[model samples]
Target: MRDRIVRRVILPVAVAAALSAVAGCSLSGGTGSHKGPAAPSGSAAGRADPQAAAALRGVEQATVRAGSARIESATAMGGMLSLRTDGALGWSGDPVGTLRITYTGGQLAATMRALSSTSLEARLLPDAYYAKVGDTFARRLQGRHWIRYGYGDLAALPGGSGAYLTDQLRDTAPLQPVRLLRACGDVRRVGEETVRGRRTTHYAGTITPAALGGADAAGLRERLEQAGVTRESVDIWVDDRGLLVKKVERGELISGRMSATAYYRDYGVKVSAGRPPAADTADFRELLSTRGS
Candidate 1:
């Protein structure tokens, strides 16, 4: 059973299909490539508007010096897991690039620029991202490889074909904090509480975008069906300073908990737009290519 589960997860059926559509290649075949959209319009409008309920989202995005948060969750399977992300705000470790996320109007745009570091190791893997460490004197580098497999597609909204992944992005928007106000949803403060010894403000809400309707909606439904999973509500916990501390959510293929802790560790006050120096894909390409080769 363990082996079967591993295999199933290794080649998430939904991901495989999505890749095939975009790359025209299967995970078993390394002949796939991803082409971005021809330049999206209406983004300006999207960024200008803020959802009515998430006014406090701005406070959460303020410059966080240093902090940490914990996440304790009960899965649909009755399993419990706890996780943490240290240095969430904007703490520049020993040396290297800087990861920043800022809100424009009401939209959240992030930029991972080259920091005072060298020997940086940034890669866009099959489903996630990783950056290497370096020194200050090194020239800053940046670029966009592709949509993070683990994160939602920023180019599109959470609906219509592949809504599963898009929805996942919006669900965890609080983790970035910038989207608290930009994301279209109803959020209510669930009062204050202490999580993992740190005092945090808890918020509960549901996101149902009317944009997720019409014939186009069928595409999203189909993608979910391919994954053998359904969409679920997302719950979040934020610190007293309004920063996101934790998020609990379930998606079609994967469900887990993500948390941030440590002073401005992985978190950033604001972000810039434009591509980075170069894209990273060595790790994921290696993982997929080795097997295929």
Candidate 2:
């Protein structure tokens, strides 16, 4: 009876966690908001510059609290994450482990793992962290923990870094069309929304890049699809400053079971910006420089 329970329940739970890691990583960053004018029919007729379009979709810096996030995967399972600026991060439906991130500046990092059904072990260190599942070293890097854990964990970190990366890529000016050609599968203006009482424009799209900055493009794409990248929806809330105040996402894996939502605040972040993930350009360079044998 004990073995059976562990196999049917515990093992599946762990697998879900592993899968969550993948989905969560991609969905991390800002919340989705605002609906913009329709993209022109052809690439030639549309706003030729994506950066300016992105800037037009940005928000200003401010601090917000009482944030919540949830994710569902089509194949394995689903999970949710919540946080209050003054309180600890909370999670539900966690399988492998629970992860909590700490943010000091615009940059963020952490270490997380599954402890049990209702509990997790997390160390949100800003500079460097060590992660392991059982005895296996999961990751040890100067990169963002979200990049390491996949998408689920990425949904919990502070700042809107994930959204930042996506927007940066999606809105690359002059070559916005080119950027979209190679970096994304499709783009659209979802609509508008109210984020923290502020009206903003919203946008959604898919990332089908040949290679992620730090992952196996093919394998990662499969993982993302399993985690709900099929109709991968990204909502960006853009204000005057062009800063992403909120980013919302709904990811579906194999069976489309896991979905997540995250909101960011305390913008104009100057502290953590120069730290790890953001500051460590050299680290990313090294990772990319590695020969893929």
Candidate 3:
């Protein structure tokens, strides 16, 4: 149970939380008062789909301008894990936030219970993230209640792809959808749709390997390849004011199929996250080293 939770639930959720922080960065369009032209419906003429590009560019600019948001998300990885998270995050330039994550169902949830609970409080900072674990797990760390995972340390983990995790946490979360759009071969407006009761413009696209290449690729292609995602589908919903309200990403990983859906709100809301008390926090790398010895 411990192994399963660590592999399937804990690690995946940590990644998801980091990515979700990025989502906050792209969804808040500065003070929530800025507005852009509405997206055109259906596919626009041209190889580059100028209409779609313009609309998404507006979303990108708005999100960067706003800088913070409240988010709710759900993620699933095949049948191994299913989880939900709710939190507020800031992405003005550096990512900062906190989340209450719950293991809702699946094998991972069962395993989490062995540690005394199926929920965790995660705090994200510019350089690392901290997870509050149950007392059962804390007992293994000389009674420490938190585990700190630094972005740099994640790169040195066992998996050769661990660096990808570090890169994503450090750089790619908020603009992942925008990157997908830039790398997509068939970006188009899917028409207007209702999301969480608000009217929004729906955009969809397919990300192919060929699309992943460019002078400014930013290593996204290599990261996707490492995860076994040859091709993936992406969907985004932008609210009437030109802010991203929701997004969905789906793809196959070497481990299994994975999907995540996230909703964003309260753009420009103030958010802050602080490091756990040093005395009560254990560095994840040290924990691993100690266990190995």
Candidate 4:
């Protein structure tokens, strides 16, 4: 009974929790080879307004240069999970940060409590994520309290979508709105607005399969397709310094409607993450192996 519950129910919920953290961290598009934002050359540029294009590129460059920021986000993944996360993330050319994630409500929330509690402390590194589970889960793991999930392992999970999820985590950052703007055929500035008491310029655009067709478009297209979205709407608020202050993504998925809203502040903040003690941590894969034995 314990093994069956752990394997069938707990593992999936745990994976979802880790994925929720990743997904909630950044609402941006996939990571590409380019170090900074540059206008897509050739015919693609012809379709976009030169002024709008320049504004987006400026936002991307300024964001990347800012390094890190405090982030607060709320994400709903169809009916699978809904979560709110608050923490700081650093993307100074690498994905590294920390977040305090809470499972407000969802089907996965019930199972999450079985392993630990609804709240989890997540440490994000360049290659993996470490989550701190509770004493209840620790008792079953020979006293280990942390579960380590490597990005490569996430890609090899039971479903093919695991790879897509892994890619999202790897490519996502606070500056993701700028990445989405790169694929927009018609990006327009919706004038200036106030976001959290700060004046910011609003930009809105739609992403379609047709707009994404270039050397750097493959990864972005794959991410959109995996989300079951033919078209996704993106809106962003950027401060005068060209930093992303807020972003929202809305789209239709096979399961249902999906959306996320994120607010960023305190740019250029110093942040750091340390690995859990190996001796006191367990790999998620090994935990599942105990099933049915």
Error of 1 at 192 (Å): 1.5
List, residue by residue over 165-230, the lDDT tens digit for candidate 1: 333322222232223223423455556677667787655443232323333345434433433323
RMSD of every candidate to native, in Å, equals 15.6, 14.5, 8.0, 7.1
- Write one digit per residue (lDDT tens) for candidate 2, span 84-192: 1221221211212123322211111111123212222231233222122222111223332321222323333345443333222221111122123223434445456
Estimate the overall C-alpha local distance difference test score of candidate 2: 0.31
Q: Where does candidate 4 clash, by residue pair?
A: none
Give the alpha carbon lDDT tens digit for every residue of 53-157 in model 4: 678888878877888888888776555567787888787866777888777656666666766767888887887877787788787778888888788877887
Instruction: Flag regions of model 1 displaced more than 4 Å.
Output: 1-52, 63-182, 209-230, 251-293
TM-score, candidate 1, is: 0.36
At residue 274, candidate 4 shows an lDDT of 92
- List TM-score per model, in order: 0.36, 0.38, 0.82, 0.82
- Candidate 3 differs from the real structure by a C-alpha RMSD in angstroms, to one decimal, of 8.0
Ten contiguous residues minimizing lDDT sum, candidate 3: 25-34
Candidate 2, poorest ten consecutive residues by summed lDDT: 103-112
lDDT of each: 0.30, 0.31, 0.66, 0.67
The stretch of ten residues in a row with the least summed lDDT in candidate 1 is 102-111
